[model samples]
Every structure is written in structure tokens, then in C-alpha cells.
Target chain A: AQSVTQLDSQVPVFEEAPVELRCNYSSSVSVYLFWYVQYPNQGLQLLLKYLSGSTLVKGINGFEAEFNKSQTSFHLRKPSVHISDTAEYFCAVTNDYKLSFGAGTTVTVRA
Target chain B: DVKVTQSSRYLVKRTGEKVFLECVQDMDHENMFWYRQDPGLGLRLIYFSYDVKMKEKGDIPEGYSVSREKKERFSLILESASTNQTSMYLCASLSQGTNYGYTFGSGTRLTVV
Candidate 1:
């Protein structure tokens, strides 16, 4: 079984400020990592994923995440944030066919 | 765009009533999943099907059952709805390989009274 841990429950940042949301996972076998963002009353949309290759994965909305194997971390980062970026973010891991998700991190970008 | 559609956006049901949440994917994906999302708990998988009539239990499958008679449709069933079962249910589908991301439905908010 695979599991994901989102270190922070909530993070507040001022608009145009940089922010990072930490995530870690535990898996016995090789896994794929993903970041998903959900806006209020809407479904989740894929931000980015780490299947293989470059450790740094770039996603939409100028978001990027670094996959650190030794640390078992896939942290999401944005150089500057907008109020539109305020949403609930989830980190997920999948080993074979099933996906394991983290509790989630709520990012609040205050204007 | 790949679209995953859930039958209802909101549903109110009495306790002990049978509840069915339907999900349909327009894409011919091989894997479909049913999950419930709760505050501070993210999304917990209830059941997933790799193919028609093939189902596998997920992390929180104790209170739910699933049916996948067709390739594009997956249904989540609550035999007896309880107050605790009231939550937002999400459905997602993915292709066979690992490169594609799962497309999710808007979700169904179920309230048991």
C-alpha cells in the first residue's frame, strides 16, 4: 500500500508572494506522484505529475514541483501567487493501479 | 477535453434509504474510481474498477459497494445511508498507462437526514 502526507494543513500567503506546499509519500514499490487543485464547489484538476525523468516538473498556472527521491518528497511551489490560486491542493501517489491521496493543503492567497 | 460526469450535484436522503451515485466517463478509459472527499481528510477511495464487472475495494470500502456493468459507467451504492455517510463523492477515470492523469467529475454532495 502507498500513502501520502501533506505536511501543512493550511498555508496563507500574500498575493505575488512565493509559496511552497510540502508533500511526502511512502511506498514499497516505484510510484507516480501527482498534484491536483480543487476550487470551491468544483472538481479537481491536475496541476502536475511525476511519472519519471526530470526531478523538477512544471505545471499549469506557473506551478512547479520537485520530486526528491531520497527525501520521499514532492513539494509544490509557485514563484508568485494570485488570488485565483487560492484553493485546496492534494498530493497523490500510485504504485500499481490504486492511488493514495494526502489529507490536502489549503492555500489561501490573500490580496 | 475528457469529461467525467456524475448524476447529481446534490442529493438529500433519509437515513436507512438506499443511495446510488452514478458516474460516467466519455473517454474509453480502462480504470474508473469512486472516492469520497471530506474536510481535512482529502479523498478516500471507496471502490475502483479496472474493467467491466471487475471491482476492487479501496481504503474506505466498508460502507459502500460498486457496480460497473458498462465500460463508461460506474455506480456507487450505499445499502443503508447513514448520517456519517453524508459527504462529497467524486468520480475519476484514467487510461491504461501511467502518463495520463485522471479526469474527475464535479462531484455529488450527499446529505443524509
Candidate 2:
């Protein structure tokens, strides 16, 4: 079984400031990690995923996440954030076929 | 590009009504999932179908059922619509051996009154 933990429920940042959303997961063996973003009233869109080969994976909208095996963490980071980047981000892990999601972190960007 | 489409963007149903939510994926993916998104709870999987007529229960599956009669379509049924069942429902599909994750539909916001 796999479980994901997103520490912060809400994160507020000003426009153009860098932001990082923390995510942690626990599993017995290898797993696939993913970060998904959901805009207001929209479905989830895959931000990035870490399957194999690469520890640092980049996705759309200039967002990136690094997988740390020692720390059991996959934290999402963006160099600079915009108001349009505000959305709910979820961290999920799947050991087999089923994916388990964290509570979620709501990112609110301000000008 | 893979596309998952949900039947409705918004829906309203009265209590005790039998409600159906439809999802279709053009990718011909073998896996289809039904999830409900709430305020505090991010996304809870209700049910998933690996293939036509083959289904599996997810984390939370009470008060809900799923049908996959065809390869490209999956349906979620609310046996009895209650206020607690009101939520944002999402449908997603995954290819058999794809590296990328599931492709999600736009989602249906169902409000049970």
C-alpha cells in the first residue's frame, strides 16, 4: 500500500515569488509519483510524474519537482509564480494500479 | 492526444433519486476511474474498471456503483442521491503501458438537493 501526505493545506504567495509545495509518500517498494493541478472548477491536469531514470522531472507551466528517495519526498517547485498559476495541487503515489492521493494544497497567488 | 469527456458539467438531483453520470474516453484505454472531489477531501476514488464489464472497488465505494459495458465508456450510478453525495465527480482513463498518468475529464459538479 502507498500513502501520500501533503503537509500544508493552503499556501499563499505574491506574484513573481517562488513557491514550493511539500509532498511526502511512504511505500514498501518502488512506486510511481505524480503531481496534478486543478484549476477552479476544472479537472486535474498532470503537472509532472517521476517514473524511472530521472529524479528531477519538469512539466507544463514551468513547474518542476524532484524526487528524493532518502527523504521519501517529492516536492513541487516553481521559480516564479503568477496569479494564473493559482490552483489546487495534489500529490499521488501508485505502487500497483491504484493511485492514492494526498489531502491537497491550495495555492493562492496574489499580485 | 487522449481525451476523456464527462457527460455533464453541472447537474442537480433531488433526494432519493437515481442518478447516472457518464464518461467516455477516446484513447481506448483499458482503465477508467470514478472519483469524487470534496472541499477537505482532495479526491476519493469510488470505483474503477480495468476492462469492459470488469470493475473494482476503490477507497470509498459506498452508495455508488459503476458500469463499463463498452470499452470507451464508463458510468457511475448513485443509488440514492443525498446531500452528502453532492460533489465534483471526475472521470479519468489510463493506457495499458503508458508512462504518463491518467487523462482526466473536465469533471461534473453534481449537487444533490
Candidate 3:
């Protein structure tokens, strides 16, 4: 079975500041990684994904994640964040068709 | 736009009552999933369907059952609703040979009292 571990439960950042959410996964075989964001009272939307080929994957809203095979980590980062970036972010990993998600990290951007 | 739709945004049911959470997707996807969201637990899969009339148990399937009579519709049924079953229920769909990236519905907040 595959599992994901998000290091931070919550992160607070100032506007225009950089932010990074750490994520690690446990899988013996090849795995796929993804990040999703959930706004208040809304469903989750895809942030980015690491399927194959590139280690650095760029997603919507100027967010990106790096898939480090050696570290078994796929961390999400943004050069600068805005107030609208306040939401809950989840890290997920999958070896099979099913995905296993971390507990999630709540990012709060203060102006 | 192509999206997944859950029947209700919020639902309140009594204990031991039968409850149904309906989900529909318009993308002609072959995979549909049911999950429950809690405060600390990000999301726990309840059930999933790969094709019409085909179902599979996810991480947590206890006290939950699912029906997929049609390709677009997947229903999650609670035979006997319990207080512990109160949570945000989400529906998602995807194509085969894919993982992680899914189109999720708005979700249904169910309260069992």
C-alpha cells in the first residue's frame, strides 16, 4: 500500500512571500504524484501532477512541484503567493489506480 | 464545462435512517469514486467503480454501499446511517490508465443525528 505524509499541518505566509509545502510518500514501485487545492466551501481542484519525464511540473495559478525520486518527495512551491492562495492543499501519491492522500496543509496568506 | 455533480450540498438524516448520496458526471468517464472528508483526515475512499455495474471497495467501505447502474451515475448508500457517518461526501471521476488527477464534485455535507 502507498501512503503520503505532509510535514506541515498549517503554514502562514505574508503576501508576495514564497511558500513551500513538504510532502513525502512511501511506495516500493514507481509512483505518480499530485497536488490539489480546496477553497472554502468548494471542491478540490488539481494544482499539478508528476506523471513521467520531467521532474519539475508546472501547474495552474503559477504553482509548481518538484518530483525528487531519491528523496521520495514531491514538494509544492510558489515564488510569491497572494491572499487568494489561502486554502487547504493536499499531497497525494499513487502506485496503483487508487490514490492515497496526506492529512493536508492549510495555507494562510496574510496581506 | 465537463464536471462531476453531486445531488445535494447538505443533507440531514436521523440515525438508522436510509441515506443516499447521488453523483453524476458528464464527461463519459469510466471511473467514479466516493470519498468522505473529515477535519483531520484529508479524504478516505469509500467505494469506486471502474465501469457500469462494477464496484470496488476502497480504504474504508464499512457501513457504506454503492450502486452504479448507469455509466454517469454512481450512488452511495448508507444502509443504516450512524452518527459517525456524518461528514463531507465527495464524488470524483476519471479516465482509465490515469491516477491522482480527478474531477471532483462540490461535495455533500451529511449530518446524522
Candidate 4:
């Protein structure tokens, strides 16, 4: 079975400041990792995913995440955040047909 | 781009009413899922269908059921709506072999009175 744990429940940052959200997972087999963002009253949109090949993957909205296999972590980072970047983010892990998701981290960006 | 469409953005119902939430995917994806979102609880999977007439229970299947009569459509049924069942319901679809992950609908916020 695969499960995900988001280390932080909420993060507050000033506009144009850097932010990082921590995520970790545990699985006995190889897994696929994903990061998704949900704006207020909106559905989740894929921020990025790590299937294979590279340890570092970039996604839309200038967001990036690194998949550390040894540490079982997939942390999302953005150098400069905007007010629009304030949203809830989720980390999920899947080995086969189903995915297990973390509780989610809510990012609130203030100007 | 793949699009997943939920039937309604918001709904209100009285207790003991049977409610059906519809979802359709234009990409003809082979898998569809239903999940409920709550404050601090994130998203919990209710059910999923891999193919037409093929359904599987997810982590939280109580008080809910799912139907996949066709390839592009999946419906979530709340047999008897209760106050506790009020939540934001989200639908998503995924291609069988792709690694792009699931495309989600805007979600339906259902409030039961």
C-alpha cells in the first residue's frame, strides 16, 4: 500500500517571497508522485508529477518539485509567489490504479 | 486538454432525499473517480470505475454508491442525504496508461439540510 503525508498543514508567505511545501510518502514498491493545487472554490489542477527519468520536475505556474527516493520525499518549491498562488496543495502517491493522498497544505499568500 | 465536467456547481437537498451527482469526461478516459472534500480532511475517494459497468469501492464507500453505465459518464448516488453528507464532491478521470494523472472537474458543493 502507498500513502502520503504532507508535513505542513498551512504556510503563509508574503508576495514575491519563496515558498516550499513538504511532502513524503511510504511504499514498498515503486510509486508515481503528483502535486496538485486547488484554488478557492475550484477543483484540483495538476501542478506536476514524477513518473520516471528526472529527479527534478517543473510544472505550470513556475512551480517545481524534487523527488528524493532515498528520503521518500517530493517537495514543491517556487522562488517567487504571487497572491494568486495562495491555494491548497495536495500530494499523492500511486503504485497502480489507485492513489493515496495527503491531508493537503493550504498556502496563503499576503501582499 | 482533457476536460471533466460535473453536473452542478452547487446543490441543496432535504434530508432523506436521494441525490445523484453526474460526471462526464470528454476524453473518453477508461477510469473515473468520485471523491468528497472537507475542511482539513482533504479528499477521500468514495468509488471508482475502470470501465463501463465496472465499479470498485474506494477507501470510504459508506452511505454512497457509484454507477458507470457508459464510458464517459459516472454517477455518484447518495441514497439518503443527511446533514453529515454535505460536502464538496469532486469528479476526476484518468487515462489507463498515461502518467499525466487525473483531470478533475470544477466540483459540486452539495449542502444537505
Candidate that scores best on DockQ: 1
Predicted candidate 3 versus true structure: per-residue lDDT over B12-61, tens digit per residue? 99999999999999978888999999987899889999999999999999
Q: Write the per-residue lDDT of candidate 4 for residues A12-110, one digit (tens) a residue.
A: 999999999999999878898999999987789899999999999999999999999999999999999999999999999888768788999999999
- Alpha-carbon error at B96 in model 1, in Å? 2.8
How far residue B29's Cα lies from its native spot in candidate 3, in Å, is 1.5
**Per-model DockQ:** 0.86, 0.74, 0.66, 0.74
After superposition, the stretches of candidate 1 with alpha carbons farther than 4 Å from their true spots are none
Candidate 4 lDDT tens digits, B43-70: 8889999999999999999999999989
lDDT of 2 at A46: 92
TM per prediction: 0.98, 0.97, 0.96, 0.97
Per-residue alpha-carbon lDDT of candidate 1 for residues B74-111, written as tens digits (9 for 90 to 100): 99999999999999999999965545678889999999
Candidate 2 has which clashing residue pairs, if any? none
Name the lDDT value of residue B28 in candidate 2: 78
lDDT tens per residue, model 2, A3-97 = 89999999999999999999999997988999999898777989999988889999899999999999999999999999999999999998877
Leading candidate by TM-score = 1
Q: Candidate 3: misplaced stretches above 4 Å?
A: B97-100
Tens digits of per-residue lDDT for model 2, B1-113: 89899999999999999999999999878889999988877788899999999999999999999999999999999999999999999998986565557888999999999
Instruction: For residues A1-111, write the lDDT of model 3, one tens digit per residue.
Output: 788999999999999999999999998899988999999999999999998999999999999999999999999999999999999999988777777889999999999
Q: So what's the TM-score on candidate 4?
A: 0.97
